[model samples]
Target: MFGLFKKKSEKQKLQEAYQKKMSEAHKVSHSNRTQADKLMAEAEEIAKKIDQLKV
Candidate 1:
């Protein structure tokens, strides 16, 4: 009867998106915080962008 089930809540969607973005960012080869931050920013608009990754 309920074929049209509701989708994930806003919070869930945001969290999922955040995690996915972070994962993608981490996979990339970033030299410094300046670049890393930019990649991370793509995931969460509110989170501060990291310039470079420590790794």
Candidate 2:
């Protein structure tokens, strides 16, 4: 029998990645400007993916 869990989609992958980045940012040094910027950019991209899904 097949399991209930399914493969992750591109959007899900990006969203999960973005969430991980945000969590890392929160846990580590808050003054890490480079990581913060990168995470923010990733989050924006994830938002775009969400928009695509909504359409």
Which candidate comes out best when scored by lDDT? 2
**Model 2: per-residue Cα lDDT over 15-49, one tens digit each:** 78778867876665378878777777777777788
TM-score of each: 0.52, 0.58
Any runs in candidate 2 off by more than 4 Å, and if so which? 1-5
lDDT of 2 at 30: 74
Q: How many backbone clashes are present in model 2?
A: 0
Per-residue lDDT tens digits for candidate 1, residues 14-51, read 66777877876776635466666776877767232322
Any runs in candidate 1 off by more than 4 Å, and if so which? 1-6, 30-35, 46-55
TM value for model 2: 0.58
Candidate that would win on TM-score: 2
